[model samples]
Target: MTYNLNRWQGYGHDRLYVNAGSRKIGWIDLKTGRVKVTSPAGWPSPIEGMVQQWLASNGLGHLRVKLKPRKRGDEITTQEFLDRIDRSRDDDQQPAVALSIKSQRRRSNAGTDLAKNRAGSAAYAAAQERSTWWRSLGRAMGMRTEDQAWRIGAEGEQIVARTLQWARLRGWRVLHAVPVGARGSDIDHVLIGPAGVITINTKHHSGQKVRAKPEVVFVGGAAKRYGQAAQYEANRAAKLLTAAAGRPVTVLSAVVIVGAKSVRGSRSAGVEIMPKSHLLVWLLFRRRTLSRTDVDELYELARRSTTWQPS
Candidate 1:
């Protein structure tokens, strides 16, 4: 016997909603063709088995039916089902779902560290208190260019992080703000997957025009050392990871320019320069160089503190 299925709007796309004489029964995914039984308790075992047989005969036997327990006074209307689907879709679209970065348990606060060191110095403390108002006034007047620069950089890193989180859906592993070297410098992000390893350096240049040549990158008509820096970061990561894994690790460098009005650059100075929006697509299409095992090994090594610390 053929079962009539009604198409209903689901979280990401359309789904097939099953009904038995106006009573809601279950739903099936339109894309994956997966079936779900909503009111399993309401239907008798014989009827459920028959329905399952019918679905299997209709070429849906490959997918397993998800059974949900029936609750008292629990009636699922079409509108309620649609609402639940919408909520699920929204949750799937969140960036945090894909961005799997292992966070450090004990984090270092640089500002707090500095403050602690100055606690015993009365003169420095008095000076710091007195300059607080002047500093605030300067910040209010937009004279704190250094602070603004740091804020822009931080914002760019966050955008890259969100983008990397989305990449997790495509089988990419990402670690953000990874500390390396002895001077407290950090690699903005490290990505490992089928495409091998990549060290991403985020540069936030809002409303600025960027141009890249073979050896130099110009931002807003001023030459910047972004390409050289990215290459150095990649090399450093490769050296550290190679030693930790006891195998050769090839690291590619990518510089993500955020909020640039226009970016005119390709691979120069062993670094790939692109705008923030295109980073995901670029990473997805790269030739696969590492297997799942290699990716996992590299990711674990990158996450360890000893891997980055100087010998």
Candidate 2:
């Protein structure tokens, strides 16, 4: 629970909203359009200055909370979260969710952090690809646009489809990897059962260290490994989907390499962390059934989050 102060009450019919970290919280009854910081003294964060700087630079004057720092040596606990909320003064209390009255602002600063990743990275779902000034190059010969990652992140849909095929041959339903929300923005694998939804994230890592189970490796002493990245992605996806679905979505992420023929690690989850020399064999073994609803959801979700390159 977060405590918010209603300093925005007198905006006079203008709508407003605030961005809290990765999740956006809409404001209530005021303009939701971006504004600069007129007042700032609520949350506790080390990056307050940076946050203020960012908001101002983006033409966003008004600002709110941004980070959730864990203690010196502790992970964020529910008790701690509630305690922090309870202890904070409510001179102006803001709800976790905000409803605003301004027009939704278009994100338009410049140079996105996405510039720092695989084109196919899931970081920014609906980002427009960068543009070129070739048409205007003759007018300004020295002008140059930074190059974007030519390799778009792997399509989550392709990855999910492959999982469905792989799990089916084993007489199991690929239940948990579907998208279920109004916009289906949150992506996750959902295997709905009488017990509940079991979320699974299928990954394709090239390294030979079975990321899920790190013990099995024959490489140069686990040289540069994929640490908590896959799990972190899976966990985040689960949380978002859970919020969207209005319930907990159990999550399990597995790295299923399509080609690591040189792998020599033992399978931690009964599967080699290495890639298969023959991609066909890997697919054949993962055949599994899924409810039509789940399949449709996954496909639709994938479509929204994914597209294709015509071969």
Candidate 3:
């Protein structure tokens, strides 16, 4: 099959993205001559030969190495591929290139958060159920269920969301309750700005002690995988945004603990775990990485519902 090649000049490296119709099959690194086949369709011998022919015709035959696809993915559904391609085209057709700095700044103020408040809604429902006299008696008697946990979780998310609002005033973009895949799973909060992208996971432990080690976190003496989950969310976000922007994107993960009586220990893996009180301070102290223009571009791309939709 014939493929379209688009040259992307990145920092210290250049790549040629290969697209078959609307689907991104793979990409080739010009610096290392490495072929990274992202989709399975690009693995066949015929497709590799075609890529080689293109390299040879362009006077870069020396860069055509063996067909060893380092990465493989199952992201080639016709409907989803076409949908993403159409969204990409729409974005290109109506880019923010002509917008003046003032206008771009104004645009960033709109829709600062995208959460649907699913947890809050559920928490409200649970509260309503407990409002009855009989239910109130049960609650006062110290009876609870897993469903009641939503209330505490929702409260924590609200606290964290409020704290993140400060970042937007400084040209940072924040997205709350970022829905991931078709399942009901979601990333608690996403902060993008000069300090780069961070996926935040909120954990609520009312008056409980918490500690973070290099691998896991201990909540009231119970080991939890909060750090790993935050990291996973960050990784997924990095992958999605990288594909959408057609460039490399890095993501950081953080876990915010709300109502914790005391917090001890260090960061978990590559994830940062801290109490809610320190979230704003920690965020503000991060080193600046992206310019105003880059932040706006990435924010626009990320805010799109289609960008976070399942593939």
Candidate with maximal TM-score: 3
Please name the candidate that would achieve the greatest lDDT relative to the true structure.
3
Give lDDT tens digits, candidate 1, residues 76-175. Answer: 5333444554554577542111111111111211112111121113222333444556666787887854444555566678777778878999889887
Give the C-alpha lDDT of model 2. Answer: 0.36
Per-model lDDT: 0.65, 0.36, 0.69
Candidates by lDDT, descending order = 3, 1, 2
Residues 119-150 of candidate 2 have per-residue lDDT tens digits of 23332233234435562453266543332221
> In model 2, which runs have C-alpha deviations exceeding 4 angstroms?
1-222, 266-311
The per-residue C-alpha lDDT of model 2 at residue 11 equals: 9
Worst 10 residues of 2 by lDDT: 102-111
Residue 225's lDDT within candidate 2 is 36
Instruction: Estimate the TM-score for candidate 3.
Output: 0.60
RMSDs, each prediction? Answer: 15.2, 19.7, 13.3
Residue-level error in angstroms, candidate 2, position 186:
10
